[model samples]
Target: MYKTQDIAVVILNWNGIELLKQFLPKVLEHSGDAHIYVADNASTDDSVNFVSKNFSTVKIIQNSQNGGYAEGYNDALQVVDEPLLCLLNSDIEVTENWLFAIIEAFNSEENTAIIQPKILDFKNKTTFEYAGAAGGFIDKYGYPYCRGRIFDTIEEDKGQYNDIIDIFWASGACFFIKNNVFNQLKGFDASYFAHMEEIDLCWRAFNANYKTKYVGFSTVYHVGGATLSNTSAKKTYLNFRNSLFTLVKNTDSKVFIRTVFRMILDGIAALRFLIQLKPKYFLAILKAHASFYKNLATIISARKEFPKRGNYAETDSIVWSYFIKKRTKF
Candidate 1:
């Protein structure tokens, strides 16, 4: 058994005591040499106390307040001295030797600064999870989807996408990055609060010439929507709004034109939501656009310090490919 002392498995928690109670044992058991820590996000619940009492060996970093995902990690990681950081979610379950494969890749792939392992669904172990299927890719329009997943469709794990490959983004659910690379990238955009921040960070990394990859051999089962339910209006709002924020901050000179087209596409999507009788979702899109337009100035200012990178998208318009051309499988 190879001992990897450089790795630190840190779980950012905000009142997820049950999830920690359920999954932390496997992480402690299976993780060979990496130290484990729970960065509590000012949870009012008994989560911090529980971990301190039961999991006495697991280190606890009690944050002053809940900063969601982006800022929570940014603050928690300030004291984590490990060279490699595994930002694991509380709702995920790891298999044996998972850390070994990731450590091995980090050792071999010098330029691969960020990596995400094969994330499968905990409910149905054979199927890919919605968060990140077989790595992430964006279309020309800035919409993100995975290899085994296109929009709402998730493919089964038939060992088809079992090869390590470069990705545009890694799922925040089980994200890994070199400590220096993370600090160099300035962590995630705290304004994002949560959803799509990982994509934004990965995009910035790509622009800086750092590669993100998917290691299919190391697998973990994720209970999707443990924090926020998938159908929640807040989730919808964050996805739509943060995606626009990402596009504006990361895209090149064509950002204005893309924003125009994207807004129109979003309108079409809202109409589809209405047709499906999901009024809340339709309203969510509208709210998202309103929020984006309101924060346009701030979002643009956020991009001033960062340089844009071209040739980032793998395909032009995943919406077109999925809807008009009916290309489901990636």
Candidate 2:
């Protein structure tokens, strides 16, 4: 197969030696002149040593400290000189066509800056994964929902969502993006740490006058959250806090005010967590708001550089209720 584009695939790993072994082989097998790079976020495990031995073709960078997800990805972005770059998670595995599919999407449009493939779960291939299943969409209120998911619900893949379409954002777990647009946006916002940085980046792309797409033609299986386990309270806090962080950063003044009002209403929902004795989750919500308020000046300054809403309702691109769609191979 002819290499259509030089792609830099950067996978962030932390103590995931087994997953590194499993996914790296498939990546190296089909990458086809694509430069593969792995950034270890200071793994205490033997992950770095293992890569150094077997994957001679791979470039491994062992960070001196465990910078959060955004920092690690920005670190990887520095060394990427290829026209196309993939921000991949360590837990994802792909077929030979994964790179090919994402590359073709970029060719479909001049303004396309980001693309995501059809993402399936590793255990059950038909089911959709958390981050990207088809592609991601968001409601008007800054709540992100994907074609495979709405709210907390994840729909069955069933070969649906195969149509080519524009999306608000794609999953960061395995994002295929353009290198120049990535650097132009200054990469992801470092303040986001782990969550919502991808969404924030896409919003910035819109501000900079580019488009993000979900390429249903290509596919990969995501094992989901291999770097950090889901049980961590830190993940919970960061996800909620960054949701609010992105809202303030991207939305117009009216939308931001509406979101703030809705968040106050949603505060009553946090009572369920407290009633269930999830004090940490309750505290997470509080800390999320506290963190946002504390950094108001900085957030405003950064957000002020972006353009406001462009005369379209944010909900126009999203469908919340039913998601079964006609499939196409193109």
Candidate 3:
């Protein structure tokens, strides 16, 4: 088993005092050997002070400003010297032996650098969470879906996806990665700010020949969207835009052709939103494309930094599979 000192369970927080109050105790109690840290993102609330006052054993790292998820972890992780880093969200609850399961996987696997445990919904424990159900996989079109979650359909935890396996990406909600791998990649793209950044990081790892895995033996419950709600227009904007940014920066071969097809699919999504009487979502897709175009040069320049990885998608077209073919359960 890996030493507790080698694994630092760092939670990135921003005005989530209530969440910390609710979930931090379990993390402190159940995380037997791993050291815990509260990386406060310059919260105006008493979340930092509360952690400092009550959880005296847990280390606290305060950033000057709230940098969202990507930069927040990038900044806080700089001071951490742990060999293994668990980037846990503030809204998650861990079960007994969760850390042990993750550590065991890393110790047993030779090339595995990133791992995500099965994520169950906190609100409904029986169902898989939306963030990263069993594990994450991307379609040929750069659309991401999970083994237990496709589109809006989330599967119940019937132990179907219980075995450990290779995954295209890991959930940021409770992501674990090696310190060296993270540093070599220079951490998550701060430009992402939040949302889909984990998938982007995992894709970069894939391109570098490192593996991402899902350990179903361990499980954690996530209160999805504690910081940003699922229905927020801002969330919609980030998901759409960051996903495009990910494909541009990481996809192997035929980048231009793949991106063209992606844009067409996005247009169809925008029209669907308009038909659903949600013009904000429609405009959000347009805004995402506009942002993608504006950042084209920078995005294209990122390709030079890393070699083209293998086609990591499990399916060719997730949109067609889900909408046209009606294959919702993954």
> Which number leads on lDDT?
3
- Clash totals in order: 0, 0, 1
Worst 10 residues of 3 by lDDT: 1-10
lDDT of 3: 0.93
Q: Write candidate 3's Cα lDDT for 49-108 as tens digits.
A: 899899889999999999999999999999999999999999999999888778889999
List the lowest-lDDT window of 10 residues for candidate 2: 321-330
Name the lDDT value of residue 60 in candidate 1: 98
lDDT of 1 by residue, 119-237 (tens): 99999999999999889999767899998999998999999989898999999999999999999989999988999999999999998899999999999999989888999989999
- Pairs that collide, model 1: none
Ten-residue segment with the worst summed lDDT in candidate 1? Answer: 1-10
Candidate 2 per-residue lDDT, tens place, 220-315, comes to: 899876655566667778877887778778877676665676577447646777998998888888888789889888988888877866532345
Tell me which of candidates 2 and 3 scores higher on TM-score: 3
Q: How many steric clashes does model 1 contain?
A: 0
Q: Using lDDT as the measure, name the better of candidate 2 and candidate 3.
A: 3
The C-alpha RMSD of each candidate to the native structure, in angstroms, is: 1.4, 3.9, 0.8
